[model samples]
Target chain A: MSDTLRPTDSQSPQPVQPLLARIKRRSFFMYAGATAGATALALAGCSKDETTPSSAATNVSFGTGDASVLNYAYALEQLEAAFYAKVAALTTSPLLAAEVPYFAKLATHEAIHRDFLRTAINRDFGGTIIPDLTPKFDSIDFTKRVKAATDTKLGILDAAKAFEDLGVAAYNGAAKLFKGSVYLGIAGQIVSVEARHAAYVRDLITPGSFATNEGTDVLGFDRQLTPTAVFAIAQTFVEQKLDASTIGQ
Target chain B: MNFFNIIDLLAEADPDVLDRFSSRRAVFNSLGTVAQRAALATSPLFLGALFQKAYAGTASLPTDILNYALTLELLEADFYRQFLAAGQIPAGAAFDAITVIKTHEDAHVAYLHDAVIKAGGTPVTGSSTAGIRFNPSLLPATYADQLKYAQVLEDTGVRAYKGRAAELIGTDLLTPVLQIHSIEARHAAHIRTMRGQQPWVSIGDDLAADANYKAAYTSGVASSTRTTVALGGTTYGIPAFNPAQPSPQESNLQQGAAGTKLALLITTGIGSTTYLPDDAAAAFDEPLQAAEVLDSSRAGGLLA
Candidate 1:
């Protein structure tokens, strides 16, 4: 649980020391640069009260230890469940008649996943579970699929595919971070289901593309992304600012 | 009270600290009356001796675990070899998918063979490796049948890796095993897609005809190895090897060491109102035991 993300005075070399100790020189610079950018963004967004550092407002710290890892997963599950719930709610949409019910099933699975992680965290690390997050889906244009990649909003299928793939990578990367065998076992149970979901969604986007290099690597391994990299992409779809500085600490 | 409280606190702080003590529960369950009383009076020396005795017969070496994986990889590779060599596979996307999967399985065999050798263990080979040879008799005749059989093998391979993962924890072997395990899952999903089925395990997955193929979903060894018991009047099937950790079945409502039932929606408290019973169980895939995996491969006629 290093307090590495705390806003520090540039004049004093105090806070940077622990950052230097914990991370490599290259990673240290990257984190410091991101924090500096966060500071600027926060300053621009806040009102006339220039005295307060908006670091707390802009960033959602994942905290530290195994509990932090669980909270990180819980946060992702919340986003996925929220996204599929929205898709399932669409009454008249471009999605095929046959495919609509499957979305409802996917929604249920993600909701069950969200609730499962919350209960696991509450039982294993009571009072440490992160609060239920508020979702932001303004960017998703659920009505139609846009051909251009640069469009601000994504079609439902496009969004579902991205979320499923990201979730699989998140679980794959986070699997080794769990210290307890019980938590590790639970992670293993959920990750394969996510992979299955990813494959199914990918095929819906393009038949026979399932498990290809688009989703899996050239070596035929599924992608594994660290929390820092995952949240960088994930935070855009989410309104709640997340800080993984202490995750798996 | 003080001693028990201390144990509880230590267990909470770092559960591995109490691993030796927890392991004692399994040993005690099987110990005779005289031996059980003797174990209770444990000095440090006696406990250490008891611990060694407990693990000596049961503990699987890292080498053994790696070789076990290597054996499965060989089985899969050989199956694909027969598949590609069959010469009747129709040309198209489905055929290409099988080819890609076959290439990956070959690479898996290569990687595991080298891994086992590097870990100071002899990699079991097809030559003179008496029990682990491939049997091509069960290779399906038609393209559709081949795809069905492929799905079964890939699903079994995924579950087999998951079954042994707990044994590899805290070792250098875990990362590679998991890497391959995820790939196997991806392979299983795509194969299922080619067969026009849902990627996730459907309730009562009726893809294969053999009753034993259900072992891919739930696996247990012969009944003689375990005594039958009932939980809330429902009789539970017992496993022959490692009775303490029975293989998980797809129909299992419970998950993790806490045994939380996802299907029950205990956390949500809405019960099956929001969540269907089948989808709740379908959401999580279960692990298979190594003994059960062996049984599956044998049944598929892939093991000589």
Candidate 2:
């Protein structure tokens, strides 16, 4: 009966192979393992530096939140305070009889801002952020008020203008990052004062220059700067590394 | 099988499904990638569109914009008034200086209002907006609060002029705005000094934390970088203007270097030499445009 069944070609069916099925399953497993391993590695890499501060603190890195923003402002304030204090301590000129009082007042103001920011950071974030600063004042002759007839004893005025104008733009650009209304309100008040300082300094250097490009932006608008851009400049004076990846995130 | 034939067979077997699939696929694919990319590629046009919406729509020149500007000045005026009233300003030589600064802000409000009126606008009357009103909630009811208020007002004033200076360019009322703008800067310096802050803290510091102050100061220093001395020459590394753009009167003045030289001269000390050169005597500094002035004034000028 077996021989008869094998001999009947029309009634016999073709044998199906199981080898291909085994190969397909093995391939699928291999791909799955690779994908799993890749995903695991990715997660591990992402979590490695989650909270630890970077080792190179002098590299001028920033954290990715409001703290970075404050650090930026603090850096600028430090630079300004330092410059004005230098000017106050060493008057380039006799400092016009009327200008002495003005400079002295400005000196006190800068000190307050510098200390206030330092205190705020310490109190609110518990983060110590006073960085060592080295200003590049080789371009400026602090000792001489004027080297030429066209040049005036307006170095302090010019320096003041640059700082005030920069301050105004920095604050305006940062206004959006503030989440709390109270902080926003405080920022608003501070920016106005900075603008006023910009105008005053510009006018001092050039009468009728205030509010103009000659004084401010001739186009009649305030300037704006992104955190990244502002930080780049601030990095110059700062010796310590600030990891600002957390700013405005 | 040929690719086309396979496609044809699939279409024939389920024409309805293929049609629906293709139509849906087209929509999804279009939505998924090309739309945003296309929009970004046309960014300049998009920016122009955005500018039009911001500056040309019915909502353009909104009252909020003006109110914001006026509110900044008002806040500053109030801070100085409060300081003067509370006797926070020390009596004696320093008091006179503070008083002069306080008066300057009052004058700023008056002149700012005048400019607003000239532009057919109304001055802000009260502080109702959350941003306009100080959050008395944050203060600890100490003199610190007062100092904080003073700092806020002074900073705001500095930014306000910076924010609005562009809008005021080429306008008839720009002169007054400029006057106020300078006076506000002086006030800011005075206040910063009062608050023990640096008068020029914001210059060249990009990472500055305060948004309002940064925005007003660092707008276009790199791109349209032009610096001219009063003595008719370029200051720093900035280039001088071409003669082609000079006005007719400027052309006549250009015939003689003396006029241009006089106009460009910068005086070092406060003396008779401080005067602009004879050729520049008739040359009034260009004023800001009304719209620009308004827009800047509103964009949190001193207050931002």
Best by DockQ: 1
Q: What is each predicted model's overall lDDT from 0 to 1? A: 0.69, 0.45
Chain A only, candidate 2, TM-score: 0.66
lDDT of 2: 0.45
lDDT of 1 by residue, A27-145 (tens): 64566576745335333334353344322243455778788989999999999999999888877867887788778879988988888778767776887877677687877898864
lDDT of 2 at B273: 26
* Best model per TM-score: 1
Model 2, position A2, has a per-residue lDDT of: 30
For each candidate in turn, the interface RMSD (Å) is 2.3, 20.6
Q: In model 1, what lDDT does residue B4 have? A: 38
CAPRI docking class of candidate 2: incorrect
